[model samples]
Target: MSKSYDAARDVFAGWEVDTEAALTALSQIPISMHCWQGDDVVGFEKKTGSSGGGIQATGNHPGRARTPEELRADLEFAYSKIPGKHRLNLHAFYMDTDESPDRDEIEYRHFIPWVDWAKEQGLGLDFNPTFFAHAKADDNLTLSHPDAGIRDFWIEHGKRSREIAARMGEALGSAAVNNIWVPDGYKDIPVDRMAARQRLEASLDTMCAEKHDKAHMLDAVESKLFGIGVEACTVGSHEFYLGYAIKRGTLLCLDMGHFHPTENIADKLSSVALSVDELLLHVSRPMRWDSDHVILQDDSILQMAQELVFTGLLDRTHIGLDFFDATISRTAAWVIGSRNMQKALLRALLLPQDRLKEVEENLDWTTRLMLTEEARDLPFAAVWEEFCERNEVPAGLGLIDDLDAYQASVAGRG
Candidate 1:
């Protein structure tokens, strides 16, 4: 379609720190595809390499284990299927195994393939806090573990991950990892509660250490909840938890869908960036009361824009597309996710940033969008009307990938 409000004007009005360069940088970001692997990773029957892990899916508890051939086959297939534009990485160290999990080839397992892929694709692999460390027979993996009094669990385990990461870096050509998603927190069955908190912090403290050898790209620290929470996560809405981690030099990974729908996410995010503890970022449109990790732009576009802009550190955000489905084929799942998130990013690019700033800072953002505004000056529909009228989308038949813009820019040899 024809252009609407100019992005340049909006950047100018907002007083962005490096307005020119930041706007220039926008064209380079691609929506990333993340997949969780292991026995559960390649569940499709049509696939040549996938194994069912001989674990029955029908049970109160889940089970998953991967045979070596099964694991190699899936990784190989993923490598071959990856397109030129989209980068690929291991989703999260392929955890979720039962206790007494096998650690054969422990040091070389995930890294060897990652190294091969990096050599092939010239890209990096994403990893997480739990990827390297084992909780051990003595240490508590869950916050609900009996030895809640232990403060050294993470201190010990994280150190191990660090050692493993150093080896992995040899394979990565000295690149900081593609991403790090930390799933550390509580589950609320509260027995030794304070002890549980200490253990959880211990886990995080290990991930927070500064490694000068490789620029540790801390993707995001996620704080989430359980259905009823037996080892209830202590990191929930507690300002001190993230603050403490930052003081030690780590970063918060914001899962966009984790917060309750009514929470003030954007403002809190501003604090997160202003605070010194963030690594990478995760963004998914949260379906109501559900962390489905669905496509973005499901929320009011204006608010999403506000949140994206408020961070002021979009340059640092890794922007992982965290979509999941238990049934679809992996390739199809990846493609569906690829389209869904690009649409959101495209929409953000289309939004008029200056107007979004006015609405975010001054108005009752949700209420104004939801049409609950009774105040005549801040009319409910007017802002949206102006917004829609002012915004512009690329006039096209299909979604555009982030790389398209870069390639087009390169074609002219500029």
Candidate 2:
């Protein structure tokens, strides 16, 4: 070990923290990187539709991956820069086939390419049912649409997506998390909110009627406060999904950008953990609004990691990133975001949680506050650099030249 890391290790030992153990734990945690970032949520379906949901990638960045092959190549490059093995979060619309299948007509065969690629890369795969960016969703309604036909179509799509996810998990020998997030809401005031929610509940029940082995696939439901067009009301609000997850025995997804701007998702982790057996976190940076900016090692992320580690919720939580900044090199965005999350986790792992808890229990607020502040000045950067070296990935400014060269190579991509 370098002299700097050794000194840092000694400093951590003073607080009864094991630097080596923290590094080992950090290496084991896999951050499932979202594939939509590579192509701005534009999947490889033969008939590509517009991104009509609140979701929007607001940049004309060149070199965005246009094909499945190109997207995979981009993802490969991203994985190379990030340390530790990770998983991929794919959308139902990103089918890698020549056949033109509508959302409801999708089958597991259409996603075989993704399964094969994941196996080859030794990565886990997660899935999402695409409920936006299609003709049926143009009115900002889907599963809860007043029209029974539209609701049935989306319900079928959700059912097929769950089946595909189960197969993917079986193939990879990991329980794939099939997270459902629909864009059903109203742009203005709604007359009967009860009816919409009741419809949504019924649709979800029918879609998830076919149960799969827990070892093969796990169901998760995501909620949103509001979106661009659906400003007045979001069908799947936090309260709606939280209660549903508890009652239905499914994981609840908490996207950082999906909540109110002032809300701290870190605080919600422990509260919801009491009810949900497992949680899916979509870590992202949001500026005043759900801007989907690249995440940094900011206070919010650090607090989130600390909560997970301190509450012993790390094992039950699936960490995934959700952001798409098309203005810069998408690969860099992935690398930086993933690494920042790992960095946050590492910092959390290095905390002397036991001592902190003891002090708080004894009502020693002064020591607790002081120790927390002191930790911020520790040699975290030194230990992080060593981690990057051990993982055979670039650290600090070394990534700049690497990403620059990659951008130049892909500059010709139309």
lDDT of each: 0.42, 0.93
Off by over 4 Å in 1: 1-26, 37-86, 89-105, 108-110, 131-157, 166-192, 206-220, 227-240, 277-279, 288-293, 300-302, 355-414
Per-candidate TM-scores read: 0.60, 0.98
How many clashing residue pairs, candidate 1? 24
Candidate 2 vs. true structure, TM-score? 0.98
Residue 101, candidate 2: Cα error in Å is: 0.4
**Candidate topping TM-score:** 2
Worst 10 residues of 1 by lDDT: 53-62
lDDT (tens digit, per residue) of candidate 2 on 350-404: 9999999999999999999999998889889988988988989988778889998
